[model samples]
Target: MKYVFDWEAFGGCLGMLVVLALIPIGAFVVYFIFNAILFILPAIVAGAIILAIPVGLFYAFKEMVFKKVE
Candidate 1:
């Protein structure tokens, strides 16, 4: 006995194979995006702290050292 060629079934199988191959590539892209977010969040927090410290010190000096004048 001989088998017949089935183009539809073959095409479906090929499509599935391509989808399976892409899964890992998608995962790598997602992983890098999360890493970029992780790095950016810390830099933003550090920037806010760096800005706050100066303003806080100025207020402290005005309240403490200049208390007698006011």
Candidate 2:
């Protein structure tokens, strides 16, 4: 019978554990910070466009009726 301890195998197993543990945490962080913003970006742009519409109409009305060139 022979007893042996393999440092390389132990280090590789530890590295794999760290990587596996980090993957889900990394995914969550990326989703919340980056991908989630990307997902909402279209809605944000749409809101800006919606907000601009009323201001545009107001400007158009002012030019048509209030801006009197006499």
Q: Write the per-residue lDDT of candidate 2 for residues 1-70, one digit (tens) a residue.
A: 4335456655655565465456555555566777776646554555565576567546643344333334
Instruction: Note the Cα lDDT for every prediction shown.
Output: 0.54, 0.54
Q: Taking the tens digit of each residue's C-alpha lDDT, what string does model 1 give over 29-70? A: 655777766655555555565576557546643444332321
Candidate 2 error regions (>4 Å): 34-70
The window of 10 residues in a row where model 1 has the poorest summed lDDT is 61-70
Q: After superposition, how far is residue 3 of candidate 2 from its true place, in Å?
A: 4.3
Clashing pairs in 2: none
**Full-model lDDT, candidate 1:** 0.54
